[model samples]
Target: MKLPSPVQWIEAQRKRGHELCLMLDTFDHKPVLQTLLKDRTHDRYSSLYSQTPIAELAGIGPFLIMLDSGDTQPLTELLNSPERHWGWLVSIAAQDFPALVQHWRERILVGQRPDQGIYRFHDNRVLGRALSSMPPEARPAYLGPAHSVCYAQGEHWLSADNRAPGQHPLPEQPHWLQVPVPPEQRARIRETNAHRFLLAHHQVAYLQLAEHRDPFDWLRLQRGRAEGWGWHAPRQLEFLLVSSLSTPEFEIPMQWHPRVYEEPSEHFERVCQEAKLLQGKGIA
Candidate 1:
């Protein structure tokens, strides 16, 4: 099935009297946006980080910017084009920016009380998967105010529409509730993270590994091996996975493995060097 491109989708939304906006994850192009928005101060944009406890980091945080459907070229051109931006499109029936900002602020922190953590729902990669995994009843809180949310996955654009219609109320304080992430969702998130890591740090190895086995299955298998080795920390598991990518059967020398009290940085470097040496000689 053919999926509509971003511009096509935006045009359709505009015709429906829906307000077009973007929830940008600016981690990669903070400077580019900073410069672009300076000349276009009339365009409404709210940094999710501003006025929050972490206000100092506002410059690098995600932004909720209203998109001028007729004129998106300026913002899109800053980083070469719209295709390079990392965010999802939001279509809202009501154009209340303050309400929209509060809606997202409430979602910034997730998980149960006392153990709450930052939720990167702004990232299109994470948003698409997270929304799919959520139950029908649980979606309203996340989809508040927005009539529909759309994101791109590979060459296809995927979206979720607000089925309930009415706006979900925002709390007086930014709410931090436990958003249920099922076991399969957890595995999917882990798989995505691992694949992103491999692509960034071990592109050739990731390509070779993908040709043999699916990245998710390989990650699950590698994760099991890491757990079997009693390595539970994220850093330790990542080190094991990266090593396995270059040298499929590589194992951390028992003596070189970090102890419970030690950090994995030193051990990661040692194991990675050993893996590289073995890969060079075809001995791993």
Candidate 2:
């Protein structure tokens, strides 16, 4: 599919009631570039990654560039400039931008477990045999027969501490075990693994850059770790572009696993509470 220009895409989303903002690097002047270079040298860092060149851009306000039909030069310049580095042209809704940043910051503060709850779907016989062989404590939560279209609903049950079988329950005592993952879940898992791997490798480095800290060393370490795991830098960059953008239609794919389930966003509950408190204060 041919993608719309960034401005056109954002405008269309706004017309649909999505309040969005665009973030891109803008070192349009030599003075700004000189200052950034001086700061970078003073920090005494070597082996800086390509993306690190535009690290300062995250601290400043976003640039709202206008585009015209057949006006591809600016976009091309932004993408191909050797002197200027740009991360993904992230177009996030205004409301979600803060929450998303907070989420990434929290992830950095407390290191994340990328493979926490990944699970592979199996046929009834296979799952049943595995469950029968395992002890009660080791068995997965919410065991029941498989359903045609209940993987998402089943996730709710799996996350809950206490769950019971409903009217049309599966054979197993815990109803959740019977909930079958959709066939497409496998593809989603692979996509999610690729996404998380990229994020896990670069998130801390990105966060450091955002804070205007010296992240060259950190970026080097991450690069080595990623290489050790047999990941290609170019492929990782492609994943980062997609994963970092928070447009209305984008969904962060997830994987299923055997760990205790928690909602991916660590600050979701806190953000909800703060919103409610503000709403209540307004009402009063």
Best by lDDT: 1
Give the residue spans of candidate 2 off by over 4 A: 1-8, 23-85, 109-284
Candidate 1 residue-wise lDDT, 91-181, digit = tens: 8775566678878876675445433445677777667666766676666776787777777765677667777644586544322234455
* Candidate 2 colliding pairs, count: 12
> What are the Cα lDDT values of the candidates?
0.66, 0.32
TM-score of 1: 0.57
Estimate TM-scores for all models: 0.57, 0.23
- Model 2 has an lDDT value of 0.32
lDDT tens per residue, model 2, 196-271? 4435555653453446533334344434433443433334423323333322222222221112454323233333
Candidate that scores best on TM-score? 1
Each model's RMSD to truth, in Å?
9.8, 22.4
lDDT for model 1:
0.66
Query: Could you tally the backbone clashes for each prediction?
Result: 0, 12
C-alpha lDDT of residue 201 in model 1? 64
